[model samples]
Target: MVSRGYKKRGVGVMGLRHVKNPILLARAMLEHGEDDLEANPRGVNSGDLDVPSAQGHTQLYGKAAEQLAQQYELELVDPSYFFTQRRWDEHVRALEREKKGQGQATWSATEYLPQGTCGAVALDQDGVICAATSTGGLTNKLTGRIGDTPAIGSGFWAEEWAEDGDPTGSSTWDR
Candidate 1:
């Protein structure tokens, strides 16, 4: 699975995975004392934490994940998103191809991947594990836009064990 450092500080476990649905979670946090809505109107951006991508939707996913965790009473752990570095590289290559007049001329065609993927893993206090992912199909991506995020076993995985036994079970998901 691909991994990267999560930078939005103070996005504790609560801010990370507990707040599923970035937009909704952000609104809730603003009502509470957990987050500053005004300062971060667009949720948390990638640069706030040094991750790549001109933008990062981790906060949005985190919020949605958090709501699910709480609704299910699951103990939230390190909530994160994984995207293939190759996919990003491919996006760049596509831009080059377009620059060479081999592809579409639209700006969105070059600025962002036609689609993106994300995943989340959660564990309960008793150690049950759950994995989830979100993504849009890889339609119309430039030749270089590799769509690995939705690939099974390549995007996300999780493991957990019973308190009194061997590993209880594991859950995995693809976009």
Candidate 2:
């Protein structure tokens, strides 16, 4: 699912499971610069190109997720978005507060999942699956930083329902 927020940003989610290593998918993004602007810009680069500096902080988590998948041989999935750091920070803080038993709060969808956002979610035939996602994260991210990508569960997850005849289990990361 790709979510975009008005005057804010957008996000995407990709999910997978029951495979060899789910984390590997996340890790691969880092090794190959899945979201590096220098390596994967949206437009042609000219000598006088005035494009803003692109951010790849989310790739950190994508790599981490890939590593976990490789080590555990589990399926992996990820959701990504192009959102502002402030909005990402808000989601992070909200998740943290929720962990502390705080009541649920409504977030501004327009500021989180805006239009023009795109992503993918993949599932295996037997219900096992893997997913990957990418985005520019907060149009103007800081010079040196990271986001929820490295935070497991928050960025990706492997879920199994009773219909699958397996005990409900999941792997997640939080930061």
Clashes of 1: 14
Model 1 misplaced stretches (Cα beyond 4 Å): 1-100, 103-110, 113-116, 142-146, 161-175
How close is each model in CA RMSD to the real structure?
15.1, 16.9
Give the per-residue lDDT of model 2 (tens digit) for 34-89.
24354324346454333222233332223333433444344533333323566667
lDDT leader: 1
lDDT of 1 by residue, 56-110 (tens): 2233233444543353344544434434676668657656766777555534544
Task: Let me know the TM-score candidate 2 reaches against the reference structure.
Answer: 0.28
| CA lDDT of each prediction against the hidden true structure | 0.40, 0.39
Each prediction's number of clashing residue pairs: 14, 46
> Candidate 1 — what's its lDDT?
0.40
